[model samples]
Target: MMLNPAQARARLRKLIRGEERVFLFLDYDGTLVPLAATPGEARPSGPLLDLLARLCTCPGLRVAVVSGRGIADLEKLLPVRGLYLAGVHGLVIRYPDGEEVWREDRAGDAKKRVEELARKLEPLLEGKKGFLLENKSAALALHYRLASPREAVEVVRRICEEARPLLREAGFVLRTGKKVVEFCPARANKGEGVDFLLSGWRGAFPVYLGDDETDEDAFRAVAEKGAGVLVSGRPRETAARYRLAGPGDVALFLAEVLQDRSPDG
Candidate 1:
């Protein structure tokens, strides 16, 4: 069962109050900003950027944005300094000090396989309206957000069938999210990213916020130690213990958190 917005906020506040340090793992799309028809259209607003910057400056608080976008794309989208970014769903991690780590270093051939699959998928999407083949270097995403539901379903089925052999050959995994299906490296996931981020910070309470199936891994990762907040308007089965209506509610909640000063203040 999902806890209501107020209940969830209160619980998070209480947890933060008790903990000396807090780590936030946030999902970019559909969590920080509303999902747009195209990924490019979902750019973060100035206020949201400001909020993140403020949070970064807050004492005893650390922030990381974990997303399926590539490191370059995430850096372009979020220009804030002192942020830990996990891009390609954790395949690449960028630290606050500008150090980058590629978790999938041994997957060189696997990446080639993904590119090959993208080439095979290009012609299939040539005549299809509203189909986008996004090659993220280490991953490939087919987005059909602009297509009709029936059209999207048929296209996804066809793509999956055609890509099955390549997926198996590359040992890649398919993940479905809001109007998108991604072929990613088997070991690349948000859970591993969260675990990696948390490993350095002992005794820090971690909270994850996300709104897609890809985020489920992260929810489970933080379940034993902290809380997972689901950003959705409708009820659904999820591992998240709390719920917020949408991006607007997320902004409100974040603002409230900033207003609630730490015990030291």
Candidate 2:
């Protein structure tokens, strides 16, 4: 059953109270920053960043921003010291204590392949107005949020007809998200990142918030061991145990948690 925003806030607080160590794994774009038609348009507000800063300071809490963005991009938005940042769908990770790692594919060919496609996509989509190509190391996203509905459909069809089959044959997969189509290598997903974060932690429950198909990986990971929350317009067969209507609700819910915290020293 889906929880209303108020109920979700209460539940999150209860979860926080139970855990000795609370790890917050959040998706960047939709979860933290408002989704913008252009990638560069998305940025978190000062109060929001301050709230995250405070959350990171919670004595027994461990927090991380696990995002689909490149590590460099995530860093630009959040300069919080000592917060673990995972990017490229968990294929790239930066630890809180000053360490970084990349998990490459078996043949070590994944990065080069994704990059090549990213370059090709720009030229392929050059004349198509209102479309964007977001090139992540492990994947590529084609955003059509600004396109007219008819144009978006045509563009997506062309992409599916041309790109999806090629990526699939190459052992990559295609996913459709909110006005966007994404292609990712099959080996890694966000779930792997969640597990990576919990590797040595003793009995820590997980809470992952995301608003897209890419996030299903993290949700699946949490559902398998702890819990998952889906931020969607309406529920489907997603791995989430709870749901919130939109980004505003997510912010309010997050703010509610911060307000309820016993004031820090």
Each model's lDDT comes to 0.88, 0.76
lDDT of 1: 0.88
- Please state every model's RMSD to the true fold in angstroms: 1.6, 2.4
For candidate 2, write residues 2-83 as lDDT tens digits. Answer: 7765677678778767777667788888777778887788888888788788777767667788877778888888888768
**Candidate 1 Cα outliers beyond 4 Å, as residue runs:** 261-265
| Position 146, candidate 1: lDDT | 93
The parts of candidate 2 lying over 4 Å away from their true place are 106-108, 233-237, 259-265
Q: After superposition, how far is residue 263 of candidate 2 from its true place, in Å?
A: 5.9
Tens digit of per-residue lDDT, candidate 1, span 1-265? 5678877887788877777888988999999999999999999999999988888878888999999998889999999987999998887899989998888866677668878999898888878899889988789999999988888898899999999898888888899888999999888899999999999898889999999999999999999999888889876888888888888988887876676643423
After superposition of all CA atoms, the RMSD between model 1 and the true structure is 1.6
Best by TM-score: 1
